[model samples]
Target: MSYEEILLETEEKMEKAATVFSDELKGIRTGRATPGLIENIRADYYGSPTPLKQMASISVPEPRMLVVKPFDVSVIKSIEKAILKSDLGMTPNSDGKILRLQVPALSEERRKQIVNQVKDLAEKAKISIRNIRRDSNRQADQLEKKSEISEDDCKSLKDEIQELTKKFEDKVNEYFDKKQKEILEK
Candidate 1:
């Protein structure tokens, strides 16, 4: 592939990696109620493990309350069970027709722990971005060795890949900072 193609592919891959990292970060709970918190819950619906959002309408009834209204009332028990079993430490209260989840306030210790976890995730994303840059560099080097591209062209391609890596890393850090602020806020 040409230098331009390699750079574009690397940029695209880095962007995807950053996006996935951000999505995972959103799943981490803060001191508020957010749909993302329970969107990943897998409830046994018709013998199939499906996401809660797929089977119910989730809404933030209040700053700390999440209300889930299942289209099928029969699945209420299943959804409650799924939520109770999750590591989110949230309790689900079902009243025949709907489920209510109250997000507990985070303790100072818990907030610190979560901040550390977010930092670890950010580090992982940075490492992955660096790995992509390394792979792109390797491909450019191979192209240069094969006489498919000049040394100067290879250097230019590597520079572009490095820039892309930096951009993605910055995005990851920005996401982590925002999450940290959310977690730390009382």
Candidate 2:
């Protein structure tokens, strides 16, 4: 394959790495209520475990409140139990039809802990991006050794891959900064 095609593929992989990191960040909790918090919750519905969103309609009734109205009223109890059992540290209040979850204010220590967690996640994302760059660089080196691509062309491709890596790393840092600010905000 041509150097151009190889660079294009590398860029696509880098973009995918960034997307995965963004999805992971969404799963991290903030002080405010967001529908994404429960979107990943798995509930036992009709003898099958499925995502909570598939079985209920989740809404942010207020900044700190999440309301889950289940399509099947019978699953209300199961939903409540699932949430209570989850790592979110939240208790669900159900009135035989819908479940209400009130997100509590984070303590100072809790906020710091969350910030640390966000930093850890950001570090992992950076590592993944770097891995992609390493793989692309290896491929470029192989092409250069095989003489399928000229030395100049291989160097240029490596430079482009490095730039892409830096761009994605910046994106990860930006996300981490925003999340850290959100966690530390009063």
Candidate 1 lDDT tens digits, 1-186: 888889989999899889989999878999999999998889999989999989999999799999999999988999999999888999998789999999999999999999999999899989989999999999999999999999999988888898899889999999999999999999
**How far out, in Å, is residue 150 in model 1?**
0.6
List the candidates' TM-scores in order: 0.98, 0.96
lDDT of 2 by residue, 1-186 (tens): 679887898889888878887888777788999998888889899899988999999999899999999998988988998898888988888788899999998999999998899898889888988898998899899999999999999999999999999998999898889888887887
List where candidate 1 sits over 4 angstroms from the true fold: none
User: What is the number of residue pairs that collide in model 2?
Assistant: 0
Kindly provide the TM-score of model 1 when superposed on the true structure, using C-alpha atoms: 0.98
Error of 1 at 3 (Å): 1.0
